[model samples]
Target: MRLSVAVCVPLALANWLLFSLSTMWADLEPRDLQFQSPLAWLALWANLLGIALLLAVLWRFGLEILEALAAAIKQLFAREVDWPAWFAELYAGLRPLPLFTLPAAALWGAWLVLFYFFDHPGGYATDVAFQIAAHALGACVYLPIFYRWRVLTKASSHDPQISG
Candidate 1:
């Protein structure tokens, strides 16, 4: 249950952030997405790659939080009376939950795409970056759900009833 909550909180917050950003993106007008030339396709591919990199960074951050929790869990299993000081502080302060930042970043990334993609009534069309940003936006929204699922999975793994 504890592990589940730890995972779920971040996921929920990330989703909330996604929702917020999606809301803003929905407000913007869609501009031309020129797939006319090879250059355009190349640009699109580059942007998508960049978004993929951003996702990787987010993954690493999530891994850090989980690793911290796993260390605390190992101590629990060893019958240690207390967690390490830094993690103990986290547990005590319930600061292990970094639910908000991850998702918000995703949303902001999408917003940047949308903001940059859309053009004025008689202006330039969408950039590859904007399209990539929009795709990134979708990816970010899912992070929270993935985190929530991870929480549930870990909680089930450590079920005391089964252990006993």
Candidate 2:
């Protein structure tokens, strides 16, 4: 069960990326396009690199993810555990790292600017909106599981007094 939660992160990310990319690609045509500036290209690459690095890190630390998921699940269902504090700890622990933060900010800033300036066609606007929502949802689903794993491992190894 823990392993499944850990595995779901990458799987969900991959699915979201694939769906978003394919939809955006299909929306574009061979013509009727304007060339982007070098700065735009840099921003695009930076966002991509940042996301790839985030995913790589998560995948590499699969065991920790599993541990977190298990711990979270235990705390969530156990009436004796303070579920609110568990959530607070989870949020504090999973606060965005620089690797994820800068790139994510760049991506978000770019999207906001694009939405403000450009007039999207057909259901393009809706598609983009859904993509953004999907990204948020993915984070919502992954963070708690990851945080639980981190806290559980930390408590077991270094803080034996801590309990669920």
Candidate 3:
């Protein structure tokens, strides 16, 4: 989890910063824009690659990160928590739908709305800002569900009664 967070956060931030720089450059005259230079193009490709890497990291380690977070939270509140009761409740609340389905669908809907309906004067900066906002929103929604799923899965695995 520490590894996942260490990697994903920096990659996401780098992508955002690169897109911001590119957007700013788009405002300059074509002849003056540095983003047209080969180095800038390399940066642009790097940003794309960073995004892919970030997605891959999340796919590979997202659950592990969430599990670590849950464990930390549980440890932090150990004196106050009722472990058995908590696990019972979590298991009771388990749903048939996959954990990520709702959040992913909502994110997709948000992207569609932003792409088709939002007014942004057709500037690169606006597009970058929208992408950033979408990603932030996705993280906000995804993390909680991830944590919940992780906790439930871990609990069931540790206690065979929960699975039964």
Candidate 4:
């Protein structure tokens, strides 16, 4: 599950990049990225490089998060701490990270869709397409929130207290 979450971020990013490249975006065309005076292909390459680096960093972090969770579970089993308090603390620790992710994903997704809209054929159809992506973005960004909620409240009463 953790692996999948980490993989999905890059997959989504690549999908956005491909969408941009296939369109009149900074790729396969020089219109959007042509604002600078020195206007070089470097601008486009830099943007692509940034995306690649972001994806790699996020992927690695995701794996590390999984590893941390595994370690936490082991600690719980070993009676090093009360499972509930530790679980709650771990959840709290991870809280800020997920909140950051949701906003970042939403903002980036909005930026991508806005770029798409700028190049798309304007009409009711274009509006509809843009709206659909917006909905998807909202849904995707809420994933972490939902997962946390489930862990805290719904999923198997996941209190970390080790049963004696």
Identify the leading candidate in terms of TM-score: 3
Number of the predicted model whose lDDT against the real structure is largest: 3
Can you write out model 4's per-residue Cα lDDT over 1-164, one digit (the tens) per residue?
33434635754766556554654244434645443334435655677777777667756685466547645554554344344644554455454555445555565555556556466456577667667765765565346544544454433344434331
Error of 2 at 57 (Å): 32
lDDT of each: 0.46, 0.53, 0.55, 0.53
lDDT of 2 at 115: 44
TM-score of each candidate? 0.29, 0.31, 0.42, 0.36
Clashing pairs in 4: 83-160, 84-160, 84-161
* Per-candidate clashes, comma-separated: 2, 3, 0, 3
- The stretch of ten residues in a row with the least summed lDDT in candidate 3 is 88-97
Which scores better on TM-score, 1 or 4?
4
Q: Between 2 and 4, whose TM-score is larger?
A: 4
TM-score result, candidate 1 = 0.29
Model 4 regions lying over 4 Å from their true place: 1-38, 63-119, 123-164
Query: What's the TM for model 3?
Result: 0.42
Query: Model 2: what TM-score?
Result: 0.31
